[model samples]
Target: MDTLKQQMEYAHNITLENCRVAKPIRFTETSSAYGGGAEGLSDGFAAGFLWLDKLGLAAKYQVTHLFRQSFFGGRYALVDMQLNPNPDLFLSVLYKRLVEGPVFQVTSIDIPAQLRLYAHCVRNAYYRTSWSTEVVRFGGDKQTLAIMHLFHYRVSY
Candidate 1:
């Protein structure tokens, strides 16, 4: 499936059939880098958004582990040899820090068809703060009304 919706459906069906044992599912090489050189680093924002969505999907499917193939040295590496972090690296960090909560189903009437939204609760280790951040990521050059959305959802105890 070329679209995220299709990918999510595929994953959901597969998980329903094969997730009985809770066995580890390894999602490796989650980078957008294909070859080497500038092209490898060309994924930019779209890639980052896709990566974040993939993480959410993985978590929704109860994926045990998600690994990034190349952190450095590769064309799609998170940082260059000098250790300066790339744009996607920050997204990776955000995923790690904010995605500790169990995945929950969300429904939105306002979201456009082309846009995607993913939500997760704050990790307990963090402070007892309720912060809701709405991120709007424009897809492609069209700059359509539909875009990517990342929400830090909260539940008060």
Candidate 2:
């Protein structure tokens, strides 16, 4: 579901210093002619996860699976899924179990109500950035069962 990506991005795109909204639904900015900011952009994706983990916010959902489907430009990405908010301790352990420490691929977990989501990167690794997440209920359970799509993208400068 696109909303998963959008929600992740919304929780991620906040300015840590001021807590301001930093991402839009799409990118429309012009980049440097030669493109130098690609490194931070790349690391940001993975860093987003680690940041969320550090804050104990990443565990809100199941993240039943994650997969890397398409890679264009200089990036490769994986889509992750979660049934709903579980807990931060679980998220931290689960992420470490699936992504790091052991490494779990998206194809490894299969469940219904499943759809794909993606993260395009421009960096070499996730250890070099500062980003995080915060999850909350979608007003109520009604919102989750009713809405199937939500989208968010960031235009980096």
Candidate 3:
């Protein structure tokens, strides 16, 4: 309908086409756990963004940033999501329905991740989660407060 929408549509088409065209014959993983790599980002986060981009949701959600954070006045856990359209909405978040462990402050950006790929990051020592699926980690302290980034765009005539 408008310039932004048009661009989104075009980008969506390109992403889907590229995914289908490339059709990753196999899945390969480069773990940041071993040796050295990026920082705080994960292979899955990267893959997930690629897949979401292919599905056209990345643009819709404007998932510019994602990560867990201490929220509810530092009483509960939250997800600090950020987008280009509205950066403020990207405040401390706690999207997960089930929050494990106590709330805590952000100690460091990426104390344990090879590549920062999560939505929010803090040193595990400062903030811990017992939930196997609820833990937030970074490869190292090099990563930014946000986990990872997935940039997008489109041009039409």
Candidate 4:
């Protein structure tokens, strides 16, 4: 995970450094992945997990925008060619609901590599204050033992 984070950060820095003249550096055709063949990435929850990880990583890197390729076509498409929604689509929606405010710092101990965690908070825009913590812990392989903690804080503003 650290290596992946470093590689993404390096690429982002290089783009910014090289595109100084442009008002904004742009990256195009970002997809979760491809080459899963006609079956569309994976048969079930595996594909959804991959996408959920990618979505979290993208947010961590501060990507201006991302395109989930083949929303309704191609082998890695989120929806079937017949317009049926897949598991990945539902995962995408869940991520969408998660990231309402800016990502914040989280500290944990002894977290297994297979289990990944992400966090954000709900902010009161009218007063510009954060009131709640929303942490999402959803990633694991066959060998991983997963335990999730949902923390809610009632802050007196």
> TM-score for every candidate vs. truth?
0.68, 0.20, 0.19, 0.63
How would you encode candidate 1's per-residue C-alpha lDDT over 1-157 as one tens digit per residue? 1364466557667867887754556677666545653543343555665566667667766667777778887657788677887777898787688657566565656655545545566766677753323333444444433323453334211
Residue 65 in model 3: lDDT: 30
Better of 1 and 2 by TM-score: 1
Give the CA lDDT, 0 to 100, for residue 59 in model 4.
64
Instruction: lDDT winner between 1 and 4, please give it.
Output: 1
Over 1-157, each residue of candidate 2 has an lDDT whose tens digit, in order, gives: 2344456455444433345643222222211112322344432343343324322222222222322222223221111123332232344344453342211122313322332222222123465532222222212223222212232433211
Q: Which stretches of candidate 1 lie over 4 Å from their true place?
A: 1-12, 37-46, 130-136, 140-157
Predicted structure 2: lDDT: 0.30
- Candidates in descending TM-score order: 1, 4, 2, 3
Go through the candidates in order and give the C-alpha RMSD of each one to the true structure. 6.0, 19.8, 19.2, 6.5
Question: Could you tell me which 10 consecutive residues in candidate 2 have the lowest summed lDDT?
Answer: 25-34
How high is the CA lDDT of each candidate model? 0.60, 0.30, 0.28, 0.57
Clash statistics: count for each candidate:
0, 10, 29, 0
Structural RMSD, model 4: 6.5
In model 4, which runs have C-alpha deviations exceeding 4 angstroms? Answer: 1-4, 13-32, 36-43, 122-157
Error of 4 at 23 (Å): 7.9
